[model samples]
Target chain A: MLAVDMAGETVRAMNGSMVAYDGEMTFKRQGMTGGEGLRGALRRRVAGESMTLMEVTGQGTVYFASEATEVTLVELAGDTLLVESDSLLALDGRLQTGVQFIGLRGMGTGQGLATTKVEGQGTVAILSDGPAIALEVAPGTPLCVDPHAYVAHRGQLQQDVVTDVNWRTVLGQGSGESVQFRYQGHGLVYVQPAERGGILEI
Target chain B: MTSTTFNAATLPANDNVNPYAFSVDLNGQWFTQKGKMIAYYGQIRFQALSAGPLDMLVAESFHSPLYAHDWIVAEGQGKLLLADRGFDINSYDLDKGNLTIRAANLLAFEPGLELKQSIIPGFLTLIGTGRFVAASNGPVHFVEPPIRVDPQALLGWADCPSPCHHYDHGYVRGVLGAARMMFGVGGTSGEEHQFDFTGEGTVLIQSSEHVTSSDAMLRELEGQIGMLGVPGLRQLHGTIAQRLAAEQQH
Candidate 1:
């Protein structure tokens, strides 16, 4: 659960995620805008990366929670944060929510081919199955992350699918972790301790 | 509370990054269960136990053929992170000692420890030395027995004899008690049956009783059923039917 103290500012949160509030507050559905106008809404529908948000405006303090999932807040300073739609919980109303094509790497992980893009300045709350660990990806030290455990990534980084497939894979003796997200460059990647069940479980 | 970040240079070597995740400083090889690895930093390669070059290592340390498909060998150098369904991750060290643990809870074990199928179905025994990681639904509690534990809460036991099933059917004594037992009248306390442990050594139990379903255990049970003849199967069928009926009544 997260408590936000608002003197009079507004915050965009996941729809129906407000648990309780004190003082005065008004929640209005973000509607078709999808935080990127009609074009963004259409792109979301086509990409299957839609996220429903509600605008909460008013005063005092408000508590927000969703399914009791662990929440971690990421503050952005005119940079981009790419996250899964479902892992997005709440964000500052000023932050721009958009969509970006991440190619077919998300196909095997079952997270889809596009990712939710949060840019501009503000704090963004992302949900994870457990506490999220932030790993730094540098030029020399690249990181290999299981796609199922990936939550989000920020900064200038190159993401690619690394496959270690061999004859053993065809013999039903493949290492369960045959595909991983290889991240290089300079950035931070967030990963939960738990791996979500994916098509690769078989 | 999300400010702390770790790079390859700072990540702990063979320690936990958090209570729910473990970081193994991989220099050579480690045996891990399928789908337990979450992430890693540096150069590492994963291959099935049946992979060509690992045959000697697999034959030396891994003795459970039933679980061969579910096991893999992680080789190379790096920090390997592992977790299981967000369970509380913990590492146990055994120096020339043996420990038997529930199959589903055993996440990853080092190659130095020899793995074998326990005589008790659904459990695996690790002999020799080295370290292994396990997960529990909650924090694990260690208790010495001379005690009876709910089977669902049992995680593992070290230096102890295998437990036997103890059914305290004391309620079915008098005529009314017999009627209750026979007709399922008063219902059960759900605590009558437990794994009774004796002698020395420590028994590990989780704080919660939610047991993660083990496919390996189910397969083990299926294998044991082959030993039963037609008459035994018939008796087992009757018992399962009664259980189903009793479950539906609830």
Candidate 2:
């Protein structure tokens, strides 16, 4: 499930039920435009998932800590780097966090994992298969993130909840709507093309 | 966890205390109704022998809504192998500064531990596992237990019934009052929304003021379970009558 589209960096199936993600990978997040029709374009979305397009950028590759136990995102931001972990041994992207209101259970019980944030910043690296998109999130804008597939964001204006949405009859409608991550600040949030969590690893 | 400056209120003005929870200076804003754009860093940790199928520690919030930052979530679940979507309850990017989110553990859709981007603004998340799907700003927005009683629908028990009002009690006094009086709760926010979920199944909720999390409110609400024991549980006469009179004064 871990794929890398970057040069030199590779996604290989290693010995034992593990995958080896070596080399550098390229990845980026796309935003939701053309409000009319938008279904998550990530190829690996689950059947009943509510995926949305993102307006952020990301890059990285997948690494294995041990067998199917976990996956790691090795990515870079400017001169900084990020290394994140995931529960799905099979996921490919420059990871981060976003709307998990629908996929909360997937990330729980370690079923699906993506990232962990520590205070401050550090040199983090990620591996993924992508054509990295570099977007600028200014002070008045912010982005929402999924913990699964993201790298990092600098800053943005934002709000913590999309707590209210009338039930929609659309694809990923009211069943479990996204809590709005309103971006009104001067920061960029990292997002992925796919909705990548919510399956039971076991 | 973010860095929090704690000047020991219990200790001394110059002293600092960093237990799990501590107070921060709000610049006169923390105690007021208006919210000042602020940043706070802190962590909540519990030493327990049990792990996995983990549960959130339900705690009463000490800071007023005005004093707390708009966003507060479990930045990380610590040094154990957390399940995908590592459990979370967060609220961030309070652009409107209107709503406070709460909930009893919502699951992550990203099954693998990876970073994710949200469609909503002013939000970003990190998953212990890349397993993520969707998350709520406040999982406790809805009544813990949806009032299924037919009479409420019939009696206009829901003041606004706009569906939005049902989520947060900050709006719609009649609806909020009815919900709290009926369920004996206003709502759950912060860590209070997290419950001891042994398995997978949604727990009902109700939002409110005095009682945010229903663990206590429900206990006090035990006074009404007897009504269910009687016939036509859906119909309320005496209990609703008395509680309504009491709530109006508050």
Candidate 3:
């Protein structure tokens, strides 16, 4: 049994079957550019059926999630964490301020991101469900990746919404029309190794 | 009870109307017969409150905070959203003109209407007749049935002669007798439980202003014997009680 020290914070299941958290809990993560072989390159896509739980605490925030059949616990800041859910979230839980969860469907895309602020002296833990790779970007740097090829991250990351689509992307090659969840805060980000979507759903 | 009466035949008329209004207040029962929202404050028998103009009964409830929905009545058919889930639904006995539902789900109620312990279909949420209460608030106050109410929220007591603590009747006949009394409320009897609401019920609600986790809840019962005195302070006492229990052991 994992004890929640906080009242509300966002959390989602990760590869390690743990929950990762932040304030304005986000759905997208930033993947690294070049360098590592397919192992690091392929870590950009792959997330499975996930639900995020967050609670608020006087000490800041605590989060919990069921990982590859295991339960994970973590602490987070006011700026990280997001909520995204569809039919998966039943009424057994509650939702609080400063947290969010995003549910992604292969045939769907919408602006489900929320606004938030995270900062200063806070302890946070991110659980990688499978093997996850971390990528860091310095201030004033712009990093890009396939929309479906990344996990969670901190920093002033903005995903611009666009409707116009190119022929190749629209023809099932995956929508070439993409938006970016840009990062900017001075915090560590956790990204799972996968490309083109979560680990092959079996 | 004012002698104000309304005539159904002399009411307004309309066509192609399904939703409607049913009002029961101090004067009597009035039906707009063609609106989505309807409110009442007293007792009255309704002809029909359904798709033929569904029933929407909202009242101040002799209990609870804001407004509330009480019992709904139709001539031969009716449906009432008595509790929170589908499990608490009760089908109307058209021939008997009665709609029976459980009691516990009746958190708060309106005047003239009662919160009763009726037989609800068995489901995950129901056990034994799932307790409920029916009440009203217009000209007269009523405890529709013998309901098992929490001793807390008993504000001030009136009639009813018996000791306070276990089972006791209402103010129907007696005015004072030691019934199993719930503190702060009048009527039959209940336990020395704290009063929590602002309105009426099987137990009267105590008078309290705002409260957070840190504030004293049972603030008004400072001099009253058997009361926790203050809600927060009572909790503190519980902690102290545990400490005392431990100290004696050593």
What local lDDT score does residue A189 receive in model 3, on the 0 to 100 scale? 35
Give each model's whole-structure lDDT: 0.91, 0.27, 0.27
Steric collisions counted per model:
0, 170, 108
Q: Each prediction's DockQ? A: 0.82, 0.01, 0.01
Q: For every model in order, what is the iRMS? A: 0.9, 17.2, 31.0
Could you give the candidate ranking by lDDT, starting with the highest? 1, 3, 2
- Highest TM-score model number: 1
Off by over 4 Å in 3: A1-65, A69-97, A100-121, A159-164, A172-189, A195-202, B1-250
TM per candidate: 0.94, 0.22, 0.23
State the lDDT of candidate 2 residue by residue for B5-122, as single tens digits.
1111221211112111112221211111111101121121211111122222212212222112211222221111111122112212212112211211222212123222212121
Model 3 lDDT, residue B122, Cα: 11
lDDT of 3: 0.27
Report the lDDT tens digits of candidate 3 across residue range B1-250. Answer: 0011222222122110111111112232222111111111112223322222332332221221111122232122111111111111111112211232222222222223422222111101111211222221111122422333343222122222211344333432353433323233454233423222222223222222211121112221232335545786778788789889978997
lDDT for A81 in candidate 3 is 39
Range of the 10 consecutive residues with the lowest summed lDDT in candidate 3 chain A: A86-95
Model 1 over residues A135-202: C-alpha lDDT tens digits? 99989999999999999999999999998887878789899888899999999999998888886653
Misplaced by over 4 Å in model 2 are A1-84, A87-115, A118-122, A127-134, A144-151, A154-159, A167-177, A199-202, B1-250
A1-202 per-residue lDDT for model 3 (tens digits)? 1333443433322222224334433332212311223443343122322233322223333344443311222234444433222211111112122223233322232323322122333443333322323334444433332233333454454433222233422443221223333344343333322223323210
